[model samples]
Target chain A: MQSTPPGLFRASWLVARKDLAIEFRTRTAFFSTLVFALLGLTIFFFAWDPTTVAAIDLAPGVLWAIFAFSGLLGLQRSFGVEQADRAMDALLAAPLDREAVYLGKAVANLLFVGGVQLVTIPALALFYNVPLAGIALPLAGVALLAAIGLVAVGTLFSSMAVNTRLAELLLPMLSLPFFLPIVVSASMTTARLLAGRPAAEAWPWLRILLAFDLVFGVACTLLFPFTVEE
Target chain B: MPQQPAGPVAASPDDPVVEAEALARQFGARRAVDGVSFVLRAGECLALFGPNGAGKTTLLRLLAGLLAPSSGHCRVAGLGIRDGKLARAHVGLVSHASMLYGALSARENVEFAAKLYGMPDPAGAARDALRSMRVLDRAEAPVRSLSRGLQQRVSIARAIVHSPHVLLCDEPYTGLDELGSAALTEALAERRDSGAALLLVTHNLGEGLALATQAAIMRRGSFVRHENRSGVDAGTYAMEYRELVTLDA
Candidate 1:
């Protein structure tokens, strides 16, 4: 005698909306991650001599490295929220597709990581004096692709790590390896695009990002149900 | 307090809402729930009483499809438990944990669940459930801000918002005060009257027996005594339960 449950995509959105609503109110993870990313950008700026490594050359690597680490902070808390009152059990018992749970969390993480990037990228550009006037659009496109890949894999590992005793340590340890390809591909593309190199030169790296997103996205969504319960 | 009907009750008493056949769950070498089986038809309530760590919670988890059984099978609302989407829509669960977002207001928490169940009017359902549980006054307050009893009330509201055909509750009386307990008792009676199948796990023998149509005393992963409530004397059930639990210990 119950109403039909929402469709998969709609259920996913509901989960996302719920997470976003909580995040909006608390803002603990989001704010902390953003601050850590901005702080990392600042430290990286002072660590290297501009004379030896040009800010433009150093900026892409620094940006992605900060993005990568900051992402772990957000991902670490993604499933951790559910552990508070065993809320994950409620979610697990729900009639929605498990994939919806994974996608919902992933979307929330993407936005969280992206929100940090939204603020941190401009901060990186400002601190390192990387010219953004000409390449803003392509750079953003690269960031979005890289984020999708990072979130897809990171969200999966986050779910796994959350159940462990050493979730904080486990998340970064398990995720960094998977994040390697994404960071490498993104930074390479960013470096080329920043150098005013032809867009054709970055095509291979972009393809790698695309391939990583496609392969891991589907694979992670499928594997998520296994990580949840017995 | 009888609630306004949340939804239409099952039309047939013979329709089984929950069924388990030889259900078993193991953790490493430990058999938490071993070869347990039961059937709960419409309007039936099964109150399970057991000592701590006797596998009562494990059995409930297996039935709810929260934990995959090591062996055997179960169905909820005539759908295989393995078919989660279809089975779970017909089920609701309340555990020791509130299973709520502490940051969200009470109303929002129930609304989230209603939306998940795809109720047509999530806000209205949440309102009615909260009102029924006597927590509507605190609907806008964050769950974390509420007292323990109030939190439990809100938890009940969330569980019943969809008017699930099967309700699985584990120690649902935890943190509730006397008034809260009475309210829960009434709610359970009303739900039973409305044809929802319930599996309640509790340590309170009196409270459990009062609402149970069928009762089971589980020990060491298996039921030592299970029978219809009418066949068991309420005065002696506590003594019997203690003896059974003591025998296992």
Candidate 2:
């Protein structure tokens, strides 16, 4: 019989790797997220007149909104496969820790959603003619931290919503409320960066994102077992 | 010939796999699992029998640490279900639902479970488990494409991947064909041989009688009768089970 290691991080990594491998093979999750994000960007680019509004002004809000919605798509599909085959019972039954499962899903969601953001950012820059040269690294960093918070709560709620009626509709309704703080902070920070504001000015939003990420991530890790239990 | 210990002989009285006292679960006004209590030792397969809504599933969930009791207390592997982190590692569950990822292959599903248990080399463990269940040939195939029987095999493989001490199965045989049932039976026997304490909730008396070393009958959130398999006949046990449930009404 195999024994679980005492460290929580190792278990979380394994879960993340497993989800990544599965996503790589199927491409179902990645492709849907990519298409959803691109479509959102396309609609926004055409909706407002470029002459009337500076594209840079709308860039941060549009980018984060697309990422948020796209991330939800990936998060929904992450657990969708587990629910389809009834594999959750098997996962719950394993001798491993529940915190491991939570962290695994969280890490997987971050990477999957982060991957979507990586793709969406360049596309948004190209379409809007905005220069991403200086802010790309910070933007990506902020996106990842914010994704952690969104995925943490989203993953927990998805487990519950998947078993209910109208899961597709229910998940967003349940998750969106919890996601407001993340969306606000991420958009505010990203907008300031895109507007060529000084780093010191954007630091407040960065701090909010950091604090939000830590509190929500830790809380979700603690609460996941209750949500997924039979 | 003397009866042999099926697997490892658990130490006596020092620890019980399961111990419950006045355990109960109430949903709204309804008492789903009410004032129930029992003890299960390692290397024992205890069959839980009841009609639908008889609270058999509820009791099984409570033991597995999947559901919390509204009143009273229960412990699994000396850990309380309320201690979700500690208790979950010692308890495992298999149910009518497969709980697998359709997009993932059988191997991936099992490997994912291994990883969740914090096992290193999840791929190696998954491969060995699938091979043991005779489903290794289809390990690379997506679960959505596998037959129901094969999917159940994957489910079984996934459950034991982490090697939990206590296994809780609720109607594991529900949609299985004869061959599938036979396969599941063999797999379960293997688990039992490993000294895992199994708590099974099933409507099939024959399967329960065949697998269980001990059996308990439940109705309306309580256990009315329980016995060792060698101590009762099938016909008599079923008749008594029906009588007990009806007696209360």
Candidate 3:
């Protein structure tokens, strides 16, 4: 007798757990992302004249910039693991709904991107000498909203580019277009929040991020099955 | 003993766990699978022999629902492969690749499959599958750390964990040694005896013939020869196969 499949939520969680477990074991992608993030921040800090332009102004742009690039590193490796032995075929052949695969992968990517942000935000504050005394929670809130948008689009493109000859190159090339709106909105929101401006001042940019997240989140989940279907 | 060809019957059996009707797939302008068709009922095994690029893998993929057929349809347990979730629940595939996570332990890999299939006790199911494949001792070892043969056993364990009704295997014997081959043969036979319909694609004629109740020789994108195993003369089949393959070449 054949077994029934788990519900979409359970199946997606299982996939996400499997992915995070593998990432935890190797630490290849996560470590590289950290190294790249820290290295990128150090260079950005020194490249500009902090004396000429306030460090506070550069912090928001620098944080989001580093976050975007480093998040790409994580996204590129997301579906790459499934290619190790064509383990993806087993996943595709399973009885679970295809959206579960997308949701699981996107959730794992969200956590991955979120983890990188957790470290990079503190590093940004230290290197750029940007004060975070009263705005840390709002800063984290903006980062979470931005990450949802990033993972939604990045995970979809990652799945599409994984089987190509130049996956590393193809992923960024395809995803950067979709990521532009996210980065712009996030940086704008962060700038307002970092300036200790009224929460109302940042609402418009936050709305853009929220809209991008909602639209792409549902669209990517629907489109993901087509990318994996051959 | 000599045997005669048992040609295609006018009608299918009452219960066919796997059925492919006029299935075809095209790549660019090339027809990888050109209108191939067959049926296997409960407890039946069909060993398909073909040369490289003869469309055997494409056919299997189409039936396994990995690749959508450009035209035609196939079914598992009377459910169309394109019928979605429930249909896939009835099928398992073991391809040339191990299809396993290298960083995951053998036990973890099997358990992952069980959980995806919604088994109530994934850990127990995984342990049972590992023990059955004779890899229980290495359950905690990372798959990448194990030998190729051991990894293949784990792959099989993962594929069978859900107790699928139709099993598809492509070049399953690729890297096995004497002992590994024996173990695989035993496992496959056990599955067949338990009423799972099977489609096995292999280049190893002797091994395939040993387990096949039905057999087919594929060339290009079509079946050049097909018959029941009882109708074949084991001693002469190798020579006949060589001639057929050479003629096609």
Clashing pairs in 2: A85-B100, A86-B98, A86-B99, A86-B100, A87-B98, A87-B99, A87-B100, A88-B99, A96-B117
Best by DockQ: 1
Q: For candidate 3, write residues B1-249 as lDDT tens digits.
A: 111112121134556788889999999999999999898998899999988999999998898888999998998887888887878877888999999999999999999998887776788888877887888999999999999989999998888887677889999988887877887888889888977788999999999999999999998889989999999987788888888888867
lDDT of each: 0.88, 0.79, 0.87
- Residue B149 in model 3: shift from native, Å? 1.1
- Winner on DockQ between 1 and 3 is 1
Candidate ranking under DockQ, highest first, comes to 1, 3, 2
Quick one: best TM-score, which candidate? 1
For candidate 3, the share of real interface contacts preserved is: 0.76
Please say which candidate is ahead in lDDT: 1 or 3. Answer: 1
Per-residue lDDT over A54-160 for candidate 1, one digit per residue giving the tens place of the 0 to 100 score: 98788988899888998999898888889999899888888789999999999998888888888988887789888886899999999999999999999999999
Clashes of each: 0, 9, 0
Give per-residue CA lDDT, model 1, range B113-145, as digits (tens).
988888878898899888888888899999999
Which whole-number lDDT from 0 to 100 does residue B186 have in model 2?
80
lDDT of 1: 0.88
| Tens digits of per-residue lDDT for model 2, B44-75 | 78899987788987787777666778989987
